[model samples]
Target: MSMLEPQAPDLRVQKWIGADGESTGPLKLSDLGSGPKILFAFQHWCRGCHVHGFPTLQRLHSALSPRGVGFAVIQTVFEGADENTFEKLRVNQLEYALPVAFGHDEPLVGATLPTFMEDYRTRGTPWFSIIDAGGRIVFSDFHLDADRIVKDLELV
Candidate 1:
């Protein structure tokens, strides 16, 4: 969202699915305080997300999760509500072998955009963001550069 200072965005997730594929109930960004945090925004029906975004995330998680980088996935259902249902959160987690907390940010009001997309000012799916341990927005972009992310994670 073109943040000038290092500030964490409001995590307005409607539902949550834990790493164990179980409901975690509602949660906020403050709830996750385990070192560096990486949040990946995707939609199940997005072809690019399935082909590239998720694979990149998986690799990033493989490399950083061991290094104490907390990972989370948010299904920002900006479109394709039928395809990107909350049930797919679990399915995608298992399918992608992602053992990280997953969130379902459904659209509100007249069904325009999900809370994450609107609050984070995400253009569309395949968005990625990172917050350092100090709760600063270190990285936010549509492209995922694994090496750059690893470098940024060091600041946390």
Candidate 2:
């Protein structure tokens, strides 16, 4: 349930809001397909997420999506449910102009954090989890430098 590493992911994230601002399914990791993928977790109200996370992810997506990399965004609601409302999912997506699958992950019944946060051991907002084409979590952390990922991709 904890300590996610580089391996086939047992993705259990429940609920999602698709890119087009509509209710969507409980998204699975496989929904991103079999190519390399990036998941950006954030809170709608998190200042750092807007200042650093979104920009970093946007840059990465712009550079990598053309190369066949997949991208998704999740509002990992750990606090301030009032501010991190599900409606913000589309608001942010449109604001950022990120045309990719966006998700809203709230803690399940009786759970303290969302399934993705628990499974990935995410510390807080502005987190990035990178999975390789092999479905392995090659990188998971709060700070992700797009440059590093680009270099890593070039080497791959």
Candidate 3:
């Protein structure tokens, strides 16, 4: 890849917080199974995350997981530190009935934003990023078109 072509940063997230259901570890982007992977960035306190973000993610996961699409959820806590605690990761995971791995992201020592947010350059909670089969971030934004994703993955 050319230097000008940005590559997907290796995922450096907090521990994989799991409750009951099975989940993959605090893995890098390359660690995800071969095929496209979706990274759902959220915060427990964000109503938008529950009302829109997760529902969007759930549709994508339910439709594409069986088709070899990998999924991971990260609670990037740039704010609401008390409400968006590590414990809430599992709560959201179970609440959504999403069986994929969940991560908790807090600001690193001396840093204002979590590692994932800094690496991905995310704006805020309810962000979504998609890493392609070759580990390239094909899409990164706050809003998603669940139907478009489902249709697009059908082609992939």
The number of the candidate with the highest TM-score is 3
lDDT of each: 0.84, 0.83, 0.85
**Candidate 2 segments exceeding 4 Å error:** 1-4
Tens-digit lDDT track of model 3 for 1-156: 545335789889957764354544676765558899899999999999999999999999989999999888898989989899877877888799998888888888999999999999999979999887877788889998999989998899
User: What TM-score does prediction 1 earn?
Assistant: 0.90
Segments in model 1 whose C-alpha atoms lie over 4 Å from true places: 1-3, 154-156
**lDDT for each residue of candidate 1 in 1-156, tens digit (9 for 90 to 100):** 444645786687879999899998776776666587888999998999998899889988998888888888999987788889989999999999999889998888786889888877789879888887777777778897887777666655
> Pick by lDDT: which candidate is best?
3
Q: Which residue pairs clash within candidate 2?
A: none
Q: Score every model by TM-score.
A: 0.90, 0.91, 0.92
- What is candidate 2's CA lDDT for residue 111? 92
The positional error of residue 115 in candidate 2, measured at the CA in angstroms, is 0.8
Model with the higher lDDT, candidate 1 or 3: 3
Provide the lowest-lDDT 10-residue window in model 3.
16-25
